[model samples]
Target: MAGAGSWFVEQPPAEPPAEASASFERLYRAFLSARAALGLALVMAQLISVVLGTTPARSTLALSLSYAVAALALWLAPQLRRGASARSLARISSPHWWSAIGVDLILFGVLHALDPSGVNYGALFVMPVLMAAVLSPRMLALATAAMATLGLLGAAAWSLLAGLDVGLKTTQAGLVGSGLFAVSLLAGELSARLAREEKAARGSLALARQQELLNRLVIDEMQEGVLVVDRRGRIRAMNPAARSLLGAASGELSWQLRGRADWQPLVLALERAYGGSAGEGGAEVDVALALDSGAARSLRLRLRFTRQREGSEELCVLFVEDNRELLARTRQEKLAAMGRVSAGIAHEIRNPLAAIAQANALLAEDVAGGRAEQLTRMVASNVQRLKRLVDDVSELAPGMQPDTQPLDVSALVQETCEDWVQVNGVEPGAQSRFRLHIGAPGLTGLFDAEHLRRILVNLLDNAHRHAEPGAGAIQATLDRHGDALDLVVRSAGAPVPHEIERHLFEPFFSTRSRGSGLGLYICRELCERHGARIDYRRATDAAANEFCVRLRTPSSASSA
Candidate 1:
């Protein structure tokens, strides 16, 4: 059992996972930032060219208008980052990239036709750089090489056909420009591939680390001792939990028994229970073992076999769960027979003791001795105590069957809480900090309403008595567990001790001063009558200890 330490409180939502809007917003912002930087640089370059005395007014205006259009294109970049549609990337990058290049090409043609020798058109590298910025490196490299060749051919043809006196070897200049563009394209492709590969490698490394961490967590935190053995029963894998249970160290699989032996009796007992039926399908078996410490223990073990090859033998995986607690309870039933016999003998003696007390009361009235009066009082008190003990023992017997019908469990819980609030005299205006979590619709099921109410009322009363002083709050929640319903009531208080938890449902046992010791015992009896079970265990993961009631609906027998 967990110790009596207060933990922090948090109310988690009862809902499924939904699509994440924050991740989409982050991707959108990244796209906009990249596009904005490119558009701003282009606009600044156009302004600088116009401020200098090298470009004509009409050309300056055309560049300014093109920059304005490119600025507008930046707003649409976020849509391009969306990968849900198959053709989204192509539609976003290809249209805008080609449009910017087409505008630049038209402007270059117009300037050469107007004044062929004066325009310093080498700055046209900006168009290809913009293409590289918008699309991936591979597409940008191919587009740049094609655009450079076309520009060279168009310039040389125009110089001859339009009669412009541009005296130069146009093919040589074209070759030089195309060579520079090719070098830039190669550099971009290599850098992009390197970045992509590095990113993929990092992702894979992180994933591997995550899986390793998960494996260690499972090995350390699991309660069931897990062992993986080959067909020959040689130990292949054993987690830390298994090692601790088996009393083995890092490297010793075969060792002679000393004061502690974990292998022989436990394993042999399970095998014997299987009765040689451990070939293929999974089988569960229970075994009793006498440990070296003179304590007999029972374990519930499950074995599963998986064949490594078609012809090869199978490997058996064993899961051993400790069932010492249940075994102890089974033994306690024998010890309780003494109490049952004592109570029965007390009942047989009670009638004669009652007659003696009545006769003594009459004799005391006649004779007036104070000693007789004191003796009479003592005899009456002892008789009453014995009668009470016998009554407590009798309540342990099984009772009436459940009268079940379908009921709205949430509404019933709400009504119960409201009635409690009223009974406690809490004002309607006062703030109630208690949280109520009711599961969704169709949580209704057939159950005995009166019996369930009695169980809840008893649990609530028990919580109210044991709750901590300052944090006078209780939370009630309803949950659907497969086809059954679960009711949980939590209050701020110390956890019930382990010794108390073991006999919590046993009749005539309690921790209170004036309690009948039958509150929880009766609750369990009622729950069992309705085809359900009530149990008490410490809530190690909450701000306070919680007592949960699991109510399984009864399966109806068909009417013949």
Candidate 2:
């Protein structure tokens, strides 16, 4: 009975050692083949002498000479092995080349002079085998044919010049030997070609297997899912990670879509935004999927599509990203940083604000009967403003969470703009009148209403304070898209100064004589807390210098 831990014991499989040993085995076989070829030559010499049936003395002399040659070959084997494996196999002239021809000629002369046998032409067979091993197949065949021709010419010259029998047996032997040499040469060439082809095939098979393994290794290691699908949308290939992310086997994805159909909405959103360059679009909404126990968890999916050539067919490779943990961790870090900064500021500024409030109250009572009363009131008002500023700073701490709910963002923008118009008292015929152009209706989203209202008010106030007198009034428009919102507040007046634009959102940074300077900074902070981003930009085509703040609609679950 094994424990559950023992049942799940993990260990690496043994494959690499097996492959290495197989490689060594191939090299050893090649070494043995070269050695066997050399041994064949020695064995052939002994067989030839035995078949000739010469006298004991003559046969012994021939056998001793062959043995001596074999011994010399053995001594050179090490050097031959070293040289043969270097670069190309060492090109060498056959040992019995011209000398073998000379021996054949002498043998013909002896048959003419001594008239031993009418025909004994066994030695000519060795030339073709030796040539095949040493040279290329085509060259070996040509050389062997030439040697056969030369042998025929030598045999004719011997018979005619010596006035010998010139009989049928001698003529037939020359013709038959030449024919055998040519046949043997052709056979050897075919054998060599087949051998080479087999070797190449083996090498190709090994490389293909290795590449497949490498692909599997890479696919298994990736964190994202990668699926290659044909134009018809049938998956053609997938990595192991892709299969796991899709909650299926790689084999299954080849012909079907994996995962839930709920992914389609996000997929369509991504496809629309990214174009064909990215197959899927970034998730604009928090994804909730029913998992075990019907438990719903949030996930952010990014899909991308790319065209690639697979054989002759074009395929779309899909890349899927899971950003749930990444998004959560990012939020956690931001909150932690905000907390530390808030704690430090409270320690440094809260006590000072309290003291200032007490001092102002005392001064107000004492200076009630003089012009000094005016100064005391001013001091008290400034102290109250400072306390408000401190409160705004404290709002930036980590614990400050946005209360998000479904609301009409357009309505919120219009309401805030109207409030700004009323506070600034911009009359219809005033030098700087304020205007609002609300975009088409039904534009809604989920957002922190209070925070959004603040964002609009901040921008409108900035425009009111900076508008040049006698210039065209400010016109603010609240525009909407399918999943995004924007506020363009344009003042038809002087362009914003470059210096002011640079430090517009820095805390405690202000250009006005008596401004708190924390308004824009607070707006930016609130927007970020709600996972919305805002930026200021001058309009390129409009007559008035325009500043814009774009917010991601709640439906757009974009990163903070």
Candidate 3:
């Protein structure tokens, strides 16, 4: 088993490739500055030799000027590298590099030749070779190293052949050559490794940016609301849905939500999430907001806490979900289940109810006297009423599948409205009271014809009951745009009561005492079955109430 301390030992953090490259570049410049200073010192030594009469004045002056020129080039190297892009910086010019190496090699050879007695300058050639290793390709660096070695030996050979008293020896030249080749090999390998790491670091940076973009898209498209707040209670980020939920304007991007009166609930919930009051399950809070229209609305929201520690600061993430949506979904599921059970029960009850009607008819036939006739008539009316009730209740049983087909929208709607008018005549003293506005008469829609007729009749019946009687009293508008058709029914009437508006389409909910409360609910179910939506709104210009049905085209209906 490993020791406890070994297991706990922390690994050194890896340096980012970009940062490492920058550091290496700085170090390379420092090396150049050091070489330049050494060259300047060498030039000063030659001047001293001339002043001391140890070397000829003419040769020393030339050598000093040549060495001074090389040193000046080395000092200016760092400035040339500044203000370049990464790719440009990574790439070294082959011509510039060759030129520098040639100048140094030639000058060092001449300086060595000029020195017949003391101080061989051949070793200075290693500076140019090492620089080539740092800035050039591996093969070129090795070649430069070989050239530098040959230049050192050639200077020594020239001294031996020319009968000059040179201080340089063959052994010193060989040792310097071997050292340069080793430095070149090591430097080349290190530079190549640095390049690979820099490339990887750049790739990692790009991937991070892509992930951030994807995360932004998902958050923007989410149905639920989300808000991120920092330790100082500043709202850092919010998606579109959250802004809509709070009734905030699009420009309210930087408002402080910490202690504002309108956003107190949000602030409190955030506090609970961060203050340890909320458990692992978070907190579920119900809030009520009074709208600008003086309408009070209640909302169920779930608050989730996500804590992220950043350095010395704590960042808390608050995820807000509207639980009213959850409740609505749950209600729809219950209704579906109830529909199945009610359908089963209605099927069983239907046969017995029919038998009772038949028995009542048989009794009416047997009794046909003065007092018995009156009683028989009363029994017949009650039996008929009971039958109608049973039929209506059975209709509420769910699973009423629609047989959808492509049908001309305007023609079908006009025909259904005509039937309704014939069955229930319009209010008295009304001329052209019922109008038809068909923007696209031949447009086709995906819907069940029978179900469509029922929906129209139900809406028209309500309109006739609530609308005033006269010309232009009721209008049915049919319009088509691309893949959708709209059917709107409007009439003059006071707006529906706010208290009853929300539950208007719910089963067993009705404003009228005599109504069964399933008319509009059944209409909604029928419309939704055919991938359509029905909504009610009071027109802005007048007190005309409107019911608009949006029916999808046959090809795109399934997506609705």
Candidate 4:
């Protein structure tokens, strides 16, 4: 029996050989094409000599036929190359090139010898020898010149033997031989120089491509939206941030609109920026994109026209700046400063608050009256609220990360839901009020259990507060998988007001006075740390709201 390893072996992928580089293949094709054209010109030259009565009709016919046949063969070389394998194509060495130049030299020699009595068509021979010098290797070019010298001498000697030279045949052959050698030397050097410049240009282009890739990476990873459009307002390119800012979901027509009337507002902005030849927008403009969701987003887009270089497409680069983010960025710095000051004070406040809670407990034990007991309960409740406020601030301290590993998502969701149901006072037998729709129950993926727990608990806590008990049942769903895990928490509730919805995840922005307003913001930060995304959408059910968490590789997933 064959060994197990021998039975199952991995084969590396196949690739073309280096010599079969696209550059060489293209050069070969061009060389063949030029030769074909040279053949036609040769036929034309022969016909013209006959018309002038400088050459006989019989010689003209023979030369014309030879040139016609060679031209047909030259034209067919590219066609043959199309069917060859990479290795075989690269195997075509310098000798093949030399052979081709030899054939061309032979044709020129025949034409020269046939019309020795007529006008010297010797200048026509320069075309093929020069062609070989420009395209073939330096050694091959020298060889081509040597072969051409032999053909010239052979043709002149034939003319002398055929009663055609007078005394100038040898002199003419020597002068032409000198010209061939000089032409080869000069053309070969120039060709070598041109080849070096071309290689340098290719290297420069590779560097330019790398720079472009880096620019694309920076743009794609920006939190601010970026839209690159043409003068026609066609979205030439856009990052995922722009897509989400415009609420353009994947494969959506509105997301990828081209030259449509709906995108006119953006196009008009481009014209305003590039209106004059100066190509500068006087200032940023606030343009609203008409989203299909019926929510119009007013975006502050700063436009600058591309440097209009000739032979290049001109475009407009629109820097999409969100007004809310601009406002938030300025406030975030102030918040960070305040957080530092408050963190120092929170410790001092905690000790006094703990003392007051202890004193209230001791007083409750001493006083048996209804008023005293009620006062103690009130004191304890307020103290707990303050402590919770303190804890929320502590959680916000920077650089915190939860331990992560592969975990069962369905089990995590189920456990958090059960804990939330117990704490929030769901009716004793109303466990079924919370629904679990697990498409992949056995699925396991990377996640921090504590982080997932906090996220789920916060989501469920909000759901219970708004719609879980009474007639409304909260729904928790874990859906179709792979590396990506989708979990959604939804419940029937009054439609979230658009005004509040805009700032829903903004830190310290809360509708409820007693609430800390950090639940969703902290949830988002936690989700981001664990390579997950949290987004709230008005539920498809008109009376419901849904928050969806997508857990995937962080780089590919961006939070709205």
Best model per lDDT? 3
How many residue pairs of model 1 clash at the backbone?
A: 0
Flag clash pairs in model 1. Answer: none
Quote the positional error of residue 165 for candidate 4 in Å: 7.3
Candidate 4 residue spans exceeding 4 A from truth: 1-99, 106-121, 151-167, 203-223, 229-282, 287-293, 307-315, 321-340, 348-392, 403-560
Model 3 segments more than 4 A misplaced = 1-94, 120-123, 162-168, 243-273, 277-312, 322-446, 460-495, 525-560
Q: What are the per-residue Cα lDDT tens digits for candidate 2 across 23-97?
A: 433543353344345335445644575688643334334543553454445334554333222112112253333
Worst 10 residues of 4 by lDDT: 2-11
Off by over 4 Å in 2: 1-13, 17-28, 31-35, 38-343, 346-348, 351-372, 395-405, 421-432, 440-442, 470-472, 506-509, 513-517, 540-543, 558-560
Scored against the true structure, residue 333 in model 3 reaches a CA lDDT of: 94
Cα misplacement distance, residue 249 of candidate 1 (Å): 21
Q: Across residues 1-560, which tens digit of lDDT does each residue of candidate 1 receive?
A: 11111010010221111212342234334544554564566566656775885454665455545555654564565454344211222232545434434444455444444443355454454454434422333444455545655665566667778775445637544764676466556555554454455446656887899999998788668877777665444676777666655556877553332324546765564355345756657678776656545666577767877755878766666777668754667766754674567556766776876787688677667756588778767776766665655554554433335677777777787778788767765444334535567887556756677667766777877777877654335667789886578898887777887877788887668787667677787687766666676666566766576778876643332221
Q: Superposing every Cα of model 2 onto the true structure, what RMSD results?
A: 23.2
Model 3 scores worst on lDDT over the 10 consecutive residues at 2-11
Q: Per TM-score, what order, best first?
A: 3, 4, 2, 1
Ranking by lDDT: 3, 4, 1, 2
- Lowest summed lDDT across 10 adjacent residues in model 1 is found at 2-11
Candidate 1: segments with Cα more than 4 A from true spot: 1-395, 426-430, 433-435, 440-442, 470-472, 537-541, 553-560
In order of listing, the candidates' clash counts read 0, 6, 0, 0
Q: What lDDT is reached at residue 322 by model 3?
A: 57
Better of 3 and 4 by lDDT: 3
